[model samples]
Target chain A: MHAIKTLSLSILLGCFSLPALAEDPADADPWEGFNRAVFSFNDTLDRYALKPAAKSYKAITPDIIETGVSNFFGNLSDVGSMLNNVLQLKGGAAGQDFGRIMFNSTVGLGGIIDVATPMGLPEHNEDFGQTLGYWGMETGPYLVLPLLGPSNIRDGLGLIPDSMVDPVAEVDPIRTRNQLYGLRIIDTRAGLLAAEELLTGDRYTAMRDAYLQRREFLVNDGKVASFDQDQF
Target chain B: MKKSIIALAVAGALTAPMVAQADATLYGSLRIKAQKLEGTSHDNLNVTDNSSRIGIKGSSELFNGATAFFQFEQAVSTDTGAWNGGRLGNLGVKGDFGTAIFGRIWTPYYSFTGAPTDILDNATSASSTYVINAHRASDVIAYVSPDMGGLTLAAAVLPTDKGAADDETLDIKHVAANYAMGGFTAGVSYLGFPAADVDVMSAALSYTAGDFYVATRYENRDAGVNGPTEEDAYEVAGSYTMGNTTLLANFINDDDNVDDVISVEVQQKLGKQARAFAAIIDSNVADGGDGFEVGYRVDF
Candidate 1:
């Protein structure tokens, strides 16, 4: 306990002594003109087609069922997250992901109920893109895919491998796989409805900054040096 | 043909905003805590939701120089998968003449006095320290005057229910005013419950300089039959922020009922909208032992 107290004091002192190292946001969008066009295309599609479907899905689905669907997909994503953690050489996080998968698959009744989080195995969002970033690959230029919305060159390429490992894509029957993919899309979109309020100023800029910041936060494991602390 | 198509798409993209409808922003924070509370007789571990909420708010131009706004916020329970609805559901108009809002909303009294020490993520702060006035009340018509030379005033009335059997209409009224100068702020608030013959008066003073902040509040409750009669409460809290980490401590003494409570917390910011914290609370009241909590919060 004494040693722990001393270590805590040292960390507190170090925190107070550290200097602020703020960095300008490196948006690095050379293809803004083209990206904006594609963003608009995706936005229009989302507003007309996908958004209404997601809204309807949210309206019709019971809360417990919706949560179960989300949890099922989330549990599946952990397989990829675990793989990425291994690739990034993060043994601890990889172990936690493995534990989450095992526990949730069985005790959680195929992840319909997320029993892992309550057990202290927190969720993580990891992919090949973050693995490449951990290995010092640059983000490259920002790009807005035709239907994928915001991404970068590195992440766009990472998507291919990610898709290959995606459990839903591995479903034996093509029809079932396609249906699962559709449900996942709608569920993901519906989950984001509550977050739509954070958008402010230019929609494009806000979306771009938020996406980039979120990517960076995930890549760095939430240790962000350039964060404006006073914004809160 | 591809070049022409690209040019046309760009044109459409640039002009899309002109045809867009007014959008309401949806935002929320999700906070969950795992805690261990040890009392004189029992100890338990539990997972608790700490005021997780989602809200949609928007404003529309009503006329020249006048705008109308509305918000509907609801509480969510992540632990139990239940929703406690209608934390704040209000509609108002804002312009040079000041703002008037009606419906269920935060009371001006609590905003002025209780909010100073309400920094912690759990119930150990405002809920435990200050219990004189309701944090948010329903059926309230509130008006806040525009800032005039660093001073702002607000008042609210909860109209009586004449048709109801209880006839408690116009029973509650609240008034508050705050002043700010440089790094220092001071505020006072009053809540009156005429039918119950109860009244609460509170004052708060706070100062912030760079990463350091300190605040104190004092409250007095007049004689009342329904609750604690002629009670007084005092609270003081301070916090220091260092980069992404903050250290906070607070103490409260309620002259009646709750006794003395003290809490300390450390919070680390994960990003602009996410934080993790660990806190401990110790209460002097009988069987009101010690509680420790660790939690993470994400706001979107």
Candidate 2:
């Protein structure tokens, strides 16, 4: 568990700091103000909110995994695409579907292909944090979310990339790169399987805050000081 | 009159061999475009893309870790409730062995070699080419193998659903292949029509050599109506991302023996859900050339 947290932290830091390795602080990113404001708003969420909500994420890890697998299989429409190009495999009775099944077995399930999984194959693990960091974004303010948890501007930007890699995100890289595509559906589902129980408060507010703070942490890589929600 | 519907029902029958589980899902893309037309002043370009569709897909866990599944797809036009043709239907089953789709779906033929959307503001009407036209033919089935060390194989057959015809009898058949790994990807496909016997072959290659994405496609169809009748299309497109804006540019060439055409497009996005796009196309046929056209599209 400690290793997981540490690794997550390292990845968060690496993704946000890449592009600005040498740039001067003077350059404003145009949307920096909106970024700052949203960043501040999200951070407040943690102080007045999320740490308690995280208990739910912690409890439902298994369900998150399940839905994650489903999502992975749902997107791999092109698994059999390549072979059809070289051979004129007609569509009817001679239907070809193994490409899809195998993809679902591996990528969808988070690389636990059972058979395919043994080949040292691993899941194409993508999350909101890694997404923002990959895009050369910077982790801005340190914020304690209302119902979510710690976050910042960099994390907010990270949401775009995270959603980009999200199994549900319509765009891809995450779409095609999912190795154990099918398993991811299950893994993500399994991860959140328990959340269904604790979802009482303003479930909407809780979810909104949790999602925002998570995105914030992903972008900032947990680098800055916590935001004071009282200011907002 | 209702051959298309019969063909559609027959497709559902094909997948019956495999037992369906609760996993089966229905999904598809729906697009409605309004544009301006060229030569024939039809006023606005009330165009519906062959791209619009809906499908049901799902899988069941079989014994010994194997899984069985199937998918059925249909062309759904917002402009018109009726299907475009046989090219729109597809159904098939998949197991640990591989995936097979029958009825009417993307032929491995069109999967790799279909024409680009850039040729026309809309495929149903303004299409400068018919190489990937799925509406003209029907009753096709295809199969794809499981991934082999990241490589997979696929093929399809477009059977002649009709008994026989007097003047025009459409009998279509085809095959195709694709390989993608890392940043470099390449694909090729071919389609054959037995009656008029028009054969269309298409190939696409896209490589993400870094931050920029470069893609190109070349397709040609022998219309057969006229000796050496040509229905060809080509596209050269590339995109680059800077901050929130992803800039895209594309150039296309469409030739159908009847009309020789060229088009260009540029697009930008504000974020994930919104975009601004503009394109211009010029067609020069065997007869006279229809100057130029400018167009745009947005997604909700």
lDDT per residue as tens, model 1, B24-95: 999999998776677654367777788899999999887587989999999988977778777999999999
Which run of 10 residues does model 2 chain B get worst, by summed lDDT?
B116-125
The best candidate by lDDT is 1
Error of 1 at A197 (Å): 58
At residue B118, give the lDDT of candidate 1: 81
Off by over 4 Å in 2: A1-232, B1-21, B43-51, B80-88, B115-129, B132-137, B149-151, B161-170, B194-198, B223-232, B242-245, B257-260, B266-276, B284-300
Candidate 1: where are CA atoms >4 Å away? A1-232, B1-20, B40-42, B128-133, B160-169, B225-228, B285-288
RMSD per candidate (Å) reads 22.2, 20.3
For residues B131-245, what per-residue lDDT tens digits would candidate 2 score against the true structure? Answer: 3454334666677877666556776666662343534443555667777789866777766666665677778777786657877777776756323557666767665554332
The lDDT per prediction is: 0.76, 0.46
Interface RMSD of each: 11.1, 17.3
Residue A41: error of model 1 in Å?
A: 78
Worst 10 contiguous positions by lDDT, candidate 1 chain A: A1-10
In Å, residue B290's CA in model 1 sits off its true spot by 0.3
